[model samples]
Target: MNAHHPPGQTAPQDRPARLTVGVVGAGRVGPVLAASLALAGHRPVAVSAVSDASLRRAAEILPGVPVVPPAEVLARAELVLLTVPDDVLPGLVAGLAETGAVRPGRILVHTSGRHGAAVLDPATRAGALPLALHPAMTFTGTSVDVQRLAGCSFGVTAPEELRLAAEALVIEMGGEPEWIDESARPLYHAALAIGANHLVTLVAQAMELLGTAGVAHPARMLGPLLGAALDNALRSGDAALTGPVARGDAGTVAAHVAQLRAHAPQAVAGYLAMARTTADRALASGLLKPGLAEDLLGVLSDTANAASATDPADASEGPEATDDGADGGDL
Candidate 1:
């Protein structure tokens, strides 16, 4: 339970330093943030939750907090957390400002990585101090999210004058603040999407392929291998490139393409794409000899053109695809 005080009195632990916090959108991110702030001596005065899940989450994470309307939330909170979706953010800020819900001197912070403080221009113009503090970690919308904040990086963007305040709030939530230029917010978000979001898709596809290959406990089978591969990639980068493509083994590459087309036809396209990309990187890094790459490139081209590389026996090789092979190295 939060330390309660009489009307207008701040939490005694921090006295005037304690803020009356309000959550505008009680989604997975909002309630978890509110709970974290409460731990940092802030008072969660009110929260706005419309859906059953949001209501339940708020109740679970922020017990005893009042569920109020947006305007009422703003009215009660000195520090307002706007944790709505990126698309809904602009309208929410505009509406709050237009409805006179934006109180001057109040802190208006949002958690959208795609947007900086500019999305909260309406609220800013209304005298609210705008801040964009987006946590870099994924959220479960549960209490787990609060713990995840520890040492997590927060992409923080704010007006120059309010930079200190923005970073301070992020620190209070147990996050390390990484200052981001307003203009770079979109690109920063895109980089994270490419790394984190696409990674999830890639892992799901790998699991599906393993299951199709008759592998039981695919996750258990993959866990250690994937862990080591990820660690090696992080530590060694392109130098860590292995497998047939890196060694310029056209025969092994052809074998993989044919096997995928025959067993997991849907995986053929992705296989070709990644193999081609990996080959390109390997060649660029001198891991693949240009003279030895012709056969591999030719096989890829033939499979792509045919769109039906069904025969593993038909997969051809170059002189380099000798007994030495890619040292039977498969990733």
Candidate 2:
């Protein structure tokens, strides 16, 4: 229940001299912030990670800090980090605001890439300053997240008055701060997804293709090569391309598609999709003749359709080409 005040009176604004922070969802981001804040001489008042084990671990890391309910944290701290999953943040903020846990003049922030500070407007309407601070790095719920934060970039969204404070917090955590508008949160997150998640999928597809030819530890084989290729791609755009597609080797591409359909039918769809995209890029780059590029892309697309029409076991059959060797396409 919310404490009542007379009309025209507002919630109190008596923040402690030291910034007391409460962290919710002590998962990867939460625990990292808790430990880092404590190490940086900030007062970590309370942290809640949902599960008993998670709370116990967080308490262990920040000794003497309470593992309490969300409302309790908001009640106790001048700064609160709603680091829960993206879907839950709005409900949590609304609940806290409705229950009067988030008082006037305090700051509330969330670390969701897909949402902005506006999602915390429920709390803001109750007079708490809302901020969104999303780190542009990946985490695996480990202590290494602290080290990864060093020199990483963060996307920060907040009202003008709160932006400086949010950026300062990220800088203190050893991350560069990039300010973005609240309305652009979705596009901002899409860029991260395209770069991070799609990159993983692309690498996995390459490895699976290599494995079809009995290459043991394909990931290990491709790691350094892929890293260098990526570095080159970043340094030089379309000119970095060097492969069968770039050379307009339609015959080789058709043979490769046929071989993939025979040996790794399971990977044919993704392989064909990427190959077609590559063909388009190659043609655009003037590396491929129009007629050759269309033919090659047609072959790749047909290979995918054929593969999808078959079973997984059928997809695992031997290649059409007898030579089961690596071509090492410069991706």
Best by TM-score: 1
Model 1, 11-78: lDDT tens per residue? 54565578999998887688888899888888999999887777888899999999999999999999
Q: Find the candidate with the highest lDDT and give its number.
A: 1
Error of 1 at 20 (Å): 1.1
Off by over 4 Å in 1: 1-12, 307-331
Could you estimate the TM-score for every candidate? 0.84, 0.81
Among residues 3 or more apart in sequence or in different chains, the pairs in candidate 1 whose N, CA or C atoms overlap within 3 Å are: none
lDDT of 1 at 119: 94
Give candidate 2 regions above 4 Å deviation. 1-18, 56-61, 304-331
lDDT of each: 0.84, 0.75
